[model samples]
Structures are given as structure tokens and as C-alpha cells.
Target: MLETDRLILRRFHKDDWQDLYEYLSDEAVVRYEPYGAFTEEECKQAAISRANQEFFWAICLKERGGEVDPIAQAAGKLIGNIYFQQQNPPDFMCWSLGYVLNPRYQGQGYATESCQAIMEHGFTKMHVRRIAAMCNPENTPSWRLLERLGLRREGHFIKHKFFKRDAKGNPLWTDTYLYAMLAEEWPVK
Candidate 1:
């Protein structure tokens, strides 16, 4: 598990289905995502699936008090998730980063904090040589967050892919902005 002053990044648990449903069910939250809002049952399966995947991290809020309690903090609300996965070819030493957060918990720096923690973990512990992220061109907030994390905007692909279909069941193609950072380019903090 990884800890920040206000957050904890740990493997997902099957019991976190309820918290997963809270955000995954919101259309606005999943707007830029590949899939549409998820049903409760989908969230349940998602939680279980995430629990079995090492790349997915459950971003939880750390309980605050006079003295931080690890046990209580571990039970804190599951506000979001971080997807940090190694790309193909083990010799490449590259990884991909992605994230989603509860709309209610946004506007604060939780997403930033959680992402930074994961990037730090990838760079220092996992020996990741490079990390990349992709976001829809229309997702300003998401790309902005990527910039805040110090990833350089590398490319812009036109009609890259489609996640959802149109009213007539046609593909809704969208542009994508690719962002990446090399280990040597990582800000020395």
C-alpha cells in the first residue's frame, strides 16, 4: 500500500463494490472513458476483477484525526482508482497511467496526490523507464492534470478511436492527446 498525507493507494477489495458503483454509475464521471456508466452488478464484478489485477490501485481517503490510525484509515472511503500497467515487452520498461475519481471528491488535489504517488512508486520502485498517458482532446481537465504531473504533451492523434456508439449505433470517433515522461526527465524532487 502507498500512503500520502490525505490518501492511500492499495489493491482493490471485492467489498469495495459499493464505492465503485457510486462513481462508475455517474455518466459525467465516465464521459471520457471507453465505456458508459456502469450498473451496480458491473461495479461488483469490476471490484472483484480489480482485486485480482495488480495494476489497479484503490485510491482511498486516509482517516484524519489527532493521530492517524492505520486500521481506520484502511477502512476509509474508496474515492477513486489508478491504473498503472506495464506495457508489452518486459525489456521496454515502459508503463501506462490512467485514473478516475468521484466527482464529489474532485476540485481538491486528491487525483493529483494519488497520481503522483503512483508515478513515484513506478519510477523508484518498479524501475519504470518511461510512462505514458492518453486522454480525449475534449477532456481539458484530464490533460491539465497530466500537465500538472509534469508529463509532456507528446502527440495528438485524429480520429484515433471510438468508445461509444452514436444514436444510430455508429462509432463516435474522438481525437486523443498523448502525454509521456521519461525517467531521466522526471522532475527531481
Candidate 2:
């Protein structure tokens, strides 16, 4: 588990389904994602599935100054999720990062904090050599976040991803920006 001053990044719990649904079910939150808004059942299953993953984490708000322990308090309110998948050939020491935040919590630096922690964990704890992330070109905030985190934009793939179906049910193809950072480039804390 990772803790920031006001947030805790921990493994997901089965009970976190409702919290996950709060954002996953919102179309706006999933707009740039390949998947559409999720049903409650899908959220529940996703929570269950994610709970067993080694790299997926639930981002929760830390409830300050309570009788309960900080971790317990922090676990109570889920605000987002993050994950990293190891690239092919585990020995390559490379991983792809992904994250989502509840729209209500955007513009607060939480995404940057959480992602920085993950990148550090990957580089130091996981002994990863490189970390990469990708976002739709239209997702300005996302690519900007990646840049702010020190991942250099490596490529822009035009019409590379069929993200979802449009209102008329036609495939919606979008461009993507790929970003990456080598461990040598990451400042060790």
C-alpha cells in the first residue's frame, strides 16, 4: 500500500464495487477510454477481478485524525484507480501505466501524485528499467499529465485506436500519443 498526505493507494476490495461504479458508470469519465460506461454488474466483476491483480490499486481519500487507523480510514473512500502491466518478456523490465480519476476529483494533482508514486515503485521496488503510457490525442489533460511526470512523448499514432462507437454507432477512431521514461531519467527520491 502507498500513502500520500491525503490519499492511499492500495489493493481493491470486493466491497469497492460501488465506489468503482461511481466513476466507471459515468460516460464522461470513460469518454477517452476504449471501454464504455460500465453496468453495476460489470463494476462488481471488475472489482473482483482487479482485487487479485498484483499491480492494480484503488485510490482512496485519507480520512484524517480519526479513531480508526489511517489506512482503514483511507480505505473507506475510493476516488480512483491505477494499474501497470509488464511488457512482453518480463526480463525486459518495462511496463505500461494506466490510470483513471473520478472527474469530480480532477485538477487537484491527485493523479500526478498517485502516478509519481507508482512510477517510483516501478523503478525502485519492481526494478523496472522503463515505464510507458499512452493516451488519446484529444485527452489533453492526460498527455499533459504524462509530460508533467517527466515521460517524454515518443510518438503520435494517427487513427491508431478505435476507441469506441459514436452516437450513430460508427467506429470512432482517434489518434494516440505514446510517452515513456527510462529509469535513468527518473529522479530517485
Highest-scoring model, lDDT: 1
Model 1 residue 125 lDDT score: 89
Worst 10 contiguous positions by lDDT, candidate 2 = 64-73
> In angstroms, how far off is 17's CA in candidate 2?
0.6
Looking at model 2, residue 1 earns an lDDT score of 90
In model 2, the Cα lDDT at residue 166 comes to: 71
lDDT of 1 by residue, 154-189 (tens): 999999999999899999999999999999886644
Q: Give lDDT tens digits, candidate 2, residues 1-189.
A: 987877789989889999899899999889888788999999999999999997898888786333445456655578899988899999998999999998878899989999998888888898999999999988899999998899999999999979677789998888989999999998733
Error of 1 at 82 (Å): 0.4
Candidate 2 error regions (>4 Å):
64-71, 167-169
Error of 1 at 44 (Å): 0.8
List clashing residue pairs in candidate 2: none
lDDT on C-alpha atoms for all candidate structures: 0.92, 0.87
Note the clash tally of each candidate: 0, 0
